[model samples]
Target chain A: MNLPAGETRELLAAEYVLGTLPPTARRRVERWILLHPELAESVRRWEHDFARLAALATPEPPPARCRRRLENFLKNERPRRRLTLIAASFWRYAAPLAVAASLFLVVVLVERVRTVERPPAGIAVLVGRHGHARWVLTMGHDRMHVVVVGRIALPPHKSYELWFEPRAGAPMIPVGLLPNRGLMTARLPAAVYVRLAHAHLLAVSLEPAGGSPTGRPTGPVLATATPQAV
Target chain B: MASPPEPALPSPPPEGRSEDPLAAAFLACRRQDPRGLEKLYELLAPQLFGFLRRMLPRKDLAEEALQDTFVNIWRRIEGYDGARGEIRTWIFAIAHHRAVDILRRERRLVPTPDTDLESLLATAPPETAHEPLAQLEETRLRDCLGRLSQDQRRVLFLAYYHDRTQEEIARRLGSPLGTVKSWMRRGLLGLRRCLETP
Candidate 1:
């Protein structure tokens, strides 16, 4: 027996707002809310109703120092945020220069590697549904390089996150977020390096900006690749 | 045709109107104004703290949740969509979520005496209270909640007020987990049907 989709969604939404859903399930529901506006509305309505019920708890004034602590936090946080904004602006201006430099570096690296023909530790070419290579990942001794091959149509407010599945039906461990364009280089974490040796497949999923919130993929798997040892 | 009338004096906001007083302060906080955060803290801290104190067993834990909730409100204010709900709901949701997180981490129960179920069933808002519409809504909710079976009501209240998981509620009531889940589902459906009645 199965519940109608709407009823099931409503129940899930209620449970989500009630704080009854387990942590992983809760994260899944949050992602569902993002993908489904109706679910979001249902969750919001439940939140409003429960918030009203929560108001039934008698109101007792918090100690005065709580206020002082918050004020102090804000005082410290403001300058830090301002500094972050300044750094953001610096990135805004430096982005084009950095892109140019990276492009040049890519060209030089690709040529030198082709001539040297040194076997990469491992390599994988992630392909889209059409079987066209979308990204090429190469694991060197200590660094992993992910380079977008062509114009990949990326959804707005979404990023492509990479993961290494150690074996069939095993927990997928997050490797890194893939760039929409150009190249991303990161020093391989020891765990990732160890997993790469036995990884069954490499996968990419569409996630919100900055990557998966739940430490697991919560969106559609857009591409996948199998590592080949040279 | 007549002489200019005297300038209209500013009148106080209407009584009994359900208006969001925190909306302006929320907007300012979104813009990173420290003063706006101060105003919000002044307005909401007491009520939020009170709610947290009830949710968490210890004063320090509740206070910790309160601070984290405010910091999250300021940082994630951009995520709040005015079209979806009120600022107050968003704020309370953050606070409630934080409290639940702490509750799960602590895994300790607050000491709630065996409450008189009859009193809760008979609960009604005081007529003298302001915000009649809100009071009416609360009354309707309470009435509907009262109608649920005692077990169902207890399960719902355990989850809602005490942040108890279904497993915990089951253990606490000596009921099977499946039974507790059914009670919760049926309780929720019944409440929804009652509240949705025009």
Candidate 2:
């Protein structure tokens, strides 16, 4: 089975992509491709070359139930709550911390009422994919303030958009876009405020520079949170 | 062993259908867009199911493998690198591996007779005989494929479409193992030459 070095590698790549290599040979080729960049490129080219043959197979659509099954699988797997542990810690210390913080805030407010003005009605700590709190969102009577609490790097032409998903069958509503740096404030319309109060979850998704063109979340959901009464 | 009579080759499709949408959908899937997978299923399920059917013995088995394949695709989409290969290739590779796994599992339980290959080949009509290849509409690869000898084509077809190994193909075609291996290598090399010719 001796072949010229290049020819042998090409044949291996061809057979590998064609699914003809036996289990052992397939595994060996998989390893070999990593060591040889040229072999890897050859494999990719063969894959493209043979792709047409795959497309030529008769289109026998899977049973309709199969679609439902896939949908169910994805639905069950997609919306992961990354901040559950943080939320649990928050709840554990909420009572004592709330009492101490409330007393301190009351005293400070008495002295600085004219300067600080109104307090937020609800506050939420959004957590990123790595389970770290990334943003602090505060909903006031007529506006929402979003402050970045952790480092988030976005591509030059991308931005983060906030969304509110109500518990009922209502569709996800776009709240506002978060600033790429520091803090941002958005005036919350009365209708949006009402929807916000009823929202079961708040999510942030990456979108184009301004926001999602579709007015819906169309990118990877980066973080999620649940607002708590202040 | 007697060779099966040749089936008529299907007519070439109209030129210039694009695979861009499929590639875009795959990219979307990688970005965690749920709709991407739905689009992928719409584009590829039928063809994948047909491919699995040729490889597996029963409809239920084929369907099961197809389901498993998509599930694996969904789970591993994030790991896919577009620079490495086309999305179609990545997907078909998954399906082929899954089909092979299923075949191996089934073979352990109900060993297939080597003699059954001759009858199966004789009776099994080429499933792609009437199907139009939308993606390859402009490519001469199909014509090059047609240029292969019947034996070479059959060996290549079973290996590609049915995910058959050289040993299984030999057992199925009632030919010597070494002969089947040589035919496969020659068939692939020949197709490579023909495809590279122009």
Candidate 3:
């Protein structure tokens, strides 16, 4: 039943407790319970109101070890929520970069496939919002992998270049050059986090050819991102 | 496991306005008494386990869920408030939900051939050869269950203890999800009334 605001959560929570809510709708209520403390309370109420009859079921105590295992499980949910929150907040700033990786990886895959149908284990193609692949896959093999970052609509004098993001610890590695067709691949020591199937982001930038002398991307690059989750 | 001799039996009439010492201790322990929680556990764990075993057909699952139930009860105690109802009711709610969550996550259900008939029965527990809690008047429970219509009772059972989602229940009963819903809502009310009667 579509509950009214005045409907007191008693009914909604009760029905929910009853499992009378369909799976999809119940998911919504379950989420709702997490977000709305009041609804959770109502559930607690209905739970107690009828718990007694369970008495009819007859008592069967769990072994002590079962109780100990339960303690560990309860602990798991607490950290699970905290970790989810950490991932959520990190994405606020990191999301745009994640998007760039997808575009870059896809372009590489398309061009490689156009020439050779084999996709190096993983691929990402970077595209312009206008539907153009600016970067294409080139080197990803059993050893070193490279992507051609090109056709980037850049300012007249600026060249686009590629940068590799690592899972952790390593600083962003500056790879090869972006010619006017703007193609560059860093023959990474290991695959970029992006090419290996899972990583945060890979980026492209507007730099003068031969990459940054300082080994970093330069210029107010038009756009960038981490590759896709293959 | 001796029933800690009902030292000072608080006259157990459907717990009224009068604070049930056990309920009070339950609430107090929930508020902060670590020992109170232990006392409450000792007082109620066996009873709750009995409740869960029938709700869950499998012994191992019942035992696992039983442990999970008390752990959650310990964790969620702070969320309970008396205004909603009695403390025991709150604990039962936790136990029921925790059990339901387990059954759903495992994708299992109480074995019933055709859960549709008004006569659908719970997979009865093994012949209680040991018949634990036989003195607890298993007859009264059987009588109370008898008072319920088969359909009403089935709705109650599935809601409290299984993987049957609302849509599944509706589909299984050959009724719309809405009908299944109302049957549950109205069934709970009927159960509440039945339990509360003098």
Candidate 4:
């Protein structure tokens, strides 16, 4: 059963502050807190309450190797381009943010592919309702990769399904559920469309079973994309 | 002759930390100052590291995860919204998740001994331990902790140290999720009540 609005939120927020909420539950509540300011305020009160509990633990020094590894990682992380600043004219700024977001996951995914040694795969971009990338997809014969770097707004009672609209001669297949955080990769069928400009459309359909049913999209189209050349 | 000169003293309000320069600096780095991120790191490293050390079984893993946590914090500072949670909570949440993720990935169990309450007593630094009165307070606090039900303390410790999700804690303790959650809420409230009653 779903929880009621405020009182239950406080109870859960306290548990979250106490560091007792389940990971899934915590993720859910965190999303809710992001949307609702009041719930977040409840969390703040509890955060201060249990904040001192850490004092009870004895400090353990880390091994020197770990620090060195982290230092190296930091030194190596190339800073990506950030979104442009806001100004009196949001209209002037909107397109750039959308364009930057479109390339974001592709940039990260491409970089990761080079260093991490993943296989050549098929990719699809899941754009937000307004044409920003809610996620990006890269599918291999056995693994599906989805990177949700941009803002994704899912309906409360439903979820967005990722569908591979293969060419008229091919078939549509289910990939996997999209996450709210960093990049994700899972197993998939194979590369169906090489050039996004030429082949099947990657589309979002709101549906049940945590994904699309009836083998076709059933909800308002959120976003679609073509492949980017590596 | 004239009215007595007003006393020239304006003491800062005791509870008013309104101008949290540190938080302000975090906000600034969040806005534009890159050094602000490093300053935040310097401020928060101990708390983050100390918390992680308690949760992980080994030091190396904890430290590795802590580094990732800080790196993410530096990179994702703009995503931090002060309105949602405590800056401390937000920072630790990242650290906590990294620790949990590492544990899940490695599939390792945290090693914790059956600690005796008295054995846990840490005599503070000489400056504080030198004072018999401070020692007395520490003794009293330990005694108060000792009075807590084992379940209560376990829940409290698990929450504080491991930052386990309620589901994980419940599964580990073999208690219902609701029971585990309420224990964290009321049990912590009880501890506070007990500690504050001078």
For DockQ, the strongest prediction is 1
DockQ of each: 0.25, 0.21, 0.21, 0.18
Highest TM-score against the true fold, candidate = 1
User: Per-residue lDDT of A24-142 in model 4, one digit per residue for the tens?
Assistant: 56656654553465776777756644544443344444555655665576567655344323332542554466557656666777786653345434455655545455776665434
> What TM-score would you give candidate 4 relative to the actual structure?
0.51
Encode model 2's per-residue lDDT on A189-214: one tens digit a residue: 54455446546688999999887776
Model 1's TM-score against the true structure: 0.62
* Fnat computed for model 2: 0.50
Q: By the DockQ metric, which is better: model 1 or model 4?
A: 1
In terms of lDDT, the poorest run of 10 residues in model 4 chain A is A189-198
Which residue ranges in model 3 land beyond 4 Å of their true spot? A1-13, A23-45, A61-230, B1-34, B108-145, B170-198
* Interface RMSD for candidate 2 relative to the native interface: 19.6
Lowest summed lDDT across 10 adjacent residues in model 2 chain B is found at: B7-16
Clash count for candidate 4 is 9
- What is the per-residue lDDT of model 1 for residues A1-230, given as tens digits with 9 covering 90 to 100? 22226767888999988878887677677545544667878887888788767655556678888888898898788533542267575556544444454445456457645532333466676766554567777766556777777568888999999887754443577766889787677776433554564466789999998888886899998877767554
Model 3, residue B163: displacement in angstroms? 4.0
Which pairs clash (backbone N, Cα, C closer than 3 Å) in model 1?
none
Number of the top-ranking candidate, with lDDT as the measure: 1
Sort order, lDDT high to low: 1, 2, 4, 3
